[model samples]
Target chain A: MANQPISEPAQKFGERVRARRHELGLSQEQLADKAGLHWTFVGQVERGRRNISLHNLLKLATGLEIDPAELVRGLRRPTG
Target chain B: MANQPISEPAQKFGERVRARRHELGLSQEQLADKAGLHWTFVGQVERGRRNISLHNLLKLATGLEIDPAELVRGLRRPTG
Candidate 1:
């Protein structure tokens, strides 16, 4: 309830990570390994089915080889 | 160091957050309260002293009432 906005940004962050992975031509398995996350969790996040913790987000950032700040930015209200 | 890139981006992220807090006219103590972080840690982060975790970043985002994605983007390679 209190974290509603957090959830939206959290899920949106997943979208950003998935997009970056695809853009870099990396698969979920590869990214999972690189980021030290479970392969299933990677898929879960990408599909917006998982609520990832901060540790996992850090792992995802490490796996994507992108700045964690970028992941934070990716959750923004994109100016359409 | 192994985490060199992460560290650089991590520090850069601190700069972004610090800028945001200053722009919002929030003191470290106030921001810390909003973000649920220790006041000392907030100070450390703004000064690029302590290495923050992803969880803290999320808290910071909430405190600033901005998208976490924006924080992530803040770590981008400025096109200057």
Candidate 2:
């Protein structure tokens, strides 16, 4: 068995979040405010530097006014 | 803004994880072993008692041989 980090999916997820936030015309600070999170934390999430928790995932989805599933759409299993 | 915990989605995700694990004929311990997680942690996830982190979510998805997006499918915004 090979062990590979799932960084690609995390990066892709971050990109989706960034794109959606842009589509909503929101600055990271504004999105963070809407999500009841700190701007730095949101930035870290956008950069895929941290693993987001489910609670925060819901917060992001609500802040973006999208389905939670939408954020993770099209993320296939990354090959190791 | 009304703040409601996203317990429903977490529960739904947990149910999906549990179902997938069962479909693969995996006990909690077995799944946990495959995912490199503790059995107690897997149990908590299956019970939706804790918010799952993205890293662990990926691990669970990989252990179940499914795409990560499938874990979050059909999770709508929980009403406040």
Candidate 3:
């Protein structure tokens, strides 16, 4: 799946991250610093290019100062 | 971090998964089939030995028949 287009869920997750980052007025670099992740990784995550791990998700939630559940709230498996 | 013990958050997440699985009276193999994941992987996840990605997390939540938020609800960053 390398180089394939991002999946819809990934895009949605990225949008949430971007929206939250914007709401907090934090640049990608700043968020990365707070999350102890690379800015490039943060950029990829915000662009739906990375399928982030739970640990990183927690880090991101911490960086954003939100409950970890907030990031994944309302997300569900697409019904057939 | 190779061979390190499971982190507290990972353990908590695993506990939630296991508890939910038990509540539904599903075996690891059954849950794995529902989640479209390998049974060994499901075992690892239940043991907190895997830091699973968001995609897989969704899969697990779907298999467990719960909102994604429920899996992560109440999780927070540990304080110093």
By TM-score, the best candidate is 3
State the lDDT of candidate 1 residue by residue for B4-78, as single tens digits: 423555567678889999999999999999878788878777665545544566678888888776766524332
- Cα lDDT of candidate 2 equals 0.79
**What DockQ would you assign to candidate 2?**
0.39
Candidate 3 lDDT tens digits, A1-80: 65442666677787899999999999999999998889998988888887788888998988888887888877765344
Residue A15 C-alpha lDDT in model 3: 85
Give the lowest summed-lDDT range of ten residues in model 3 chain A. Answer: A1-10
Each prediction's DockQ?
0.25, 0.39, 0.66
CA-based DockQ, model 3: 0.66
Q: Per-residue error at A80 for model 3, in Å?
A: 10
Chain B TM-scores of the candidates? 0.76, 0.86, 0.87
Candidate 3: residue A26 lDDT (0-100): 99
For candidate 3, give the lDDT of residue B76: 61
Return the TM-score for candidate 1, rounded to 2 decimals. Answer: 0.55
Model 1: per-residue Cα lDDT at residue B47: 62
Best-to-worst ranking by DockQ = 3, 2, 1
Q: Which prediction has the highest DockQ against the true structure?
A: 3
Mind giving the per-residue lDDT tens digits that candidate 1 earns over A1-80? 43242355556767888899998899999988887778987887876665564446667877787776677663432221
Fnat value of model 2: 0.50
